[model samples]
Target: MPIIQFQLIPHTTQDGLPYQHLRFQITTEDGLMEPQDLKGLKLPENVQWSQGIVIEGKGPIWLYGYLVHECHPSSWVGCYDPRLGIVVVSSHTHAVKVGNVLPIQLPA
Candidate 1:
């Protein structure tokens, strides 16, 4: 199996609010995955469930809500920010950088 990487996209929603959503891309896989492929998606054994995909700096970005969208295989997964009313697709992920070291965690 290949390692699946996910990123967060920051954009405004229809109402023009700040928000971000998750977008997944396979690192070593040949093609995109279907919605069904995410049914039982789980992190690797070395990863911790408490770890979340960092969007900003060292802190974790919390999702206001989660939604399932009808999208192509290349970009899948959607989330909504009620506070800012923003929505994002095919977003990017941020890694915590400190001096010469960097740490990153993925959403479980």
Candidate 2:
């Protein structure tokens, strides 16, 4: 299962809003219960919850995690330039999987 979390960004808009991020993490966490067992999981109690973006959609998040473990670098994400590799990493946190195809952008 992915470790869900958020990052804080300062807003420069008129009202200075708080930008909250949702991370359906594909972390280096050693072992997790099967995706089926995450249990329609509502996020935990007393943890920081985002009021910024509402996540909506139906799809396999954890299953995508499984597929990343099997795909190649350029197959999933279109861009895989070696020269841009370092630049790409600086842009986002790399997906921690058993393979090279980084899943930086998650399923919507």
What Cα-based lDDT does every candidate model obtain?
A: 0.33, 0.29
Candidate 2, 1-108: lDDT as tens digits: 334332222221123323222223333364344566444544323322322221212235564343223222221212222332111111111332222332223222
Among all windows of ten consecutive residues in candidate 2, which has the lowest summed lDDT? 84-93
Worst 10 residues of 1 by lDDT: 57-66
What TM-score does model 2 achieve against the real structure?
Answer: 0.25
Judge candidate 1 at residue 79 and give its lDDT. 32
TM-score each candidate: 0.28, 0.25
- Best by the TM-score measure: 1
